[model samples]
Target chain A: QTASPAVAKPSRLGLCASCHGETGMAVMPGAPNLAGQRLDYLRQALKDYRDGRRDAPVMRAAIGPIGAAELDALARWYSAQAPAAASAP
Target chain B: QTASPAVAKPSRLGLCASCHGETGMAVMPGAPNLAGQRLDYLRQALKDYRDGRRDAPVMRAAIGPIGAAELDALARWYSAQAPAAASAP
Candidate 1:
């Protein structure tokens, strides 16, 4: 197999960029880093936050107005970024 | 506020403890550590893996037969563990 091309940065990052950073390496404390996360997991999480299945007020507010396609784009963007190294041995 | 008491370990961890560790710190490569993750996120992820909403053959096989309450207990157990430090600056 070959390496995949870089994912495009979504135009509608909105509040997601504030906490999750432009590259999805969370800029805020307590915000989970999104870089290199599973695309499906990220997609589901955004939906959960938007629809209140996740029960996080801040995340819900951040994602409330976002639609499904935009959410999928965001998930792809984040999932393509390089994740920081693991902290544990 | 008082410190929360330790969460009890679920006996039905099954293959979870093999890759995710007894304490959720991920003993296997490519597996994300689960310690100190949000309880809701962990809960949702488990359901996702089991239901095929998030596709990972290993995870699906590991969690396929697990029930809701057992999954919740597992989530609580992992969420209560101390996370390793962040790898990023």
Candidate 2:
């Protein structure tokens, strides 16, 4: 069997993968795809969700306990992922 | 009557304001608050929706006919808006 790719998942990604897939393609309707997004934008979004600057109960609950450094790491991971192709309509 | 602040609306913002408010605060559930999001990120999102890189039927239909320069203008307008305070939970 061929060896699988060794992509290390960011530890702080916690529950984000449930909706935003491991590589940042959104798995559910209404969740924005996060792959290949700007790092700073992702950082800001995480911060916003955690700090109550953006209001989304599910997001707040998921990211609330995460710290600034951890948030940055999560942002970096999602931003670095390859953007998936458009889903079949 | 008191003169309201002279915020110029971007012409290309067409149907976006119906959901993503004129100032980018989302008006409906499931629509993300876009106020103060990164200009480049917003521009990229608009392009992705228009070009089918990101698949959302509503976003695709809304932005498909818009041009690049117009999309950029809409991004600039939304990114410049003040981020709204988080809604009461």
Candidate 3:
């Protein structure tokens, strides 16, 4: 029997997984955890980053040219995630 | 009978609560959430801010003069907190 391909979880956070872990925990101190944020908040923030309302060098590069619908999808994916409980590193 | 003062939770995140929320969830887009981060990462971050290794204007001001023990305490408190689940805002 052939093994099934690993299922991809629904998320628009593809690039976000670099500094922010695949699970939404931030891998770098400079990065913020994205899990469990308010969807509206994340949406607005993304908009701001795209429009230069927020001055984040890293974010500016990361958010380059992505438009609205996908932004919403990203927000939906991240906001839907519940951050896991603290545990040993 | 005197009511006892509300007991302070153990944390060095006093100023952090202004933007990061009392619960380690960041209120601002530019600010990163701290919940569920590894303790060592958090400690190193706070130290970076304190020592000018990190260039954050707000953090530079916030981390002024705190001792090593307090930075450790802050990391401990924050890392111990599991971010609450996502819910409708």
Candidate 4:
């Protein structure tokens, strides 16, 4: 129904901003750049991390107790950005 | 030095093919299609899963004791594929 400013500008979002950089460019090695990533992929990834299907402790810690709505917001926010491909690996 | 036949044909390569589909199209709802994904991202992902940085039991069991060379091979194989979009949640 309504929008939260935090959800609107995901680049500046807390925690996620650290390793993933402001716009999902990824600030460190081993972190996948989320910009321009398919919304479905980002959703699945975050979901997997939350559900223990994927092992990312930092991610779990960073995104604690996230629900479907929040996951969607975060995924949508990151997927729309222009991902930095070269910074990967 | 020389490529293993198993490594060459990644689409049919073991458990990865089960969920990711032959061409990385994704067989299930939570699976991320790997086609056209950046090499760096793929590398970090596989590495994270193997090293326990990412908590994927199925992945860990599927890829046991994988070395850098194998990781590179898998990453290269998956990255070279033409990823399928439109499967987002």
lDDT of 2 by residue, B1-89 (tens): 11113335777665888977777666665466565555555776787778776565677777767887788778777756654333210
Q: TM-score: which candidate is best?
A: 4
lDDT of 1 by residue, B22-69 (tens): 766566665666665556667777877787766666886788778888
Candidate 3 per-residue lDDT, tens place, A1-89, comes to 11112323445566877876665666775676666666777787788888886656888998898878778877766666667665345
Chain A in model 1: its TM-score? Answer: 0.83
Model 2: residues with Cα > 4 Å off, grouped in runs: A1-89, B1-7
**How much lDDT does each candidate structure score?**
0.66, 0.63, 0.67, 0.65
Q: Where in model 4 is the C-alpha error above 4 Å? A: A1-30, A33-41, A44-70, A79-89, B1-7
DockQ of every candidate structure = 0.08, 0.04, 0.28, 0.24
Model 1 clashing residue pairs (backbone): none
Query: Candidate 2, overall lDDT?
Result: 0.63
Error of 1 at A65 (Å): 21
Looking at model 3, residue B34 earns an lDDT score of 62
Residue B9: error of model 2 in Å? 1.5
lDDT of 1: 0.66
TM-score of each: 0.52, 0.49, 0.56, 0.58
- How accurately is candidate 3 docked according to DockQ? 0.28
Q: How far in Å is the alpha carbon of B54 misplaced in model 1?
A: 0.9
Report lDDT (Cα) of residue B21, candidate 2: 75
In candidate 1, which residue ranges exceed 4 Å CA deviation? Answer: A1-89, B1-5, B86-89
Clashes of each: 0, 0, 0, 9
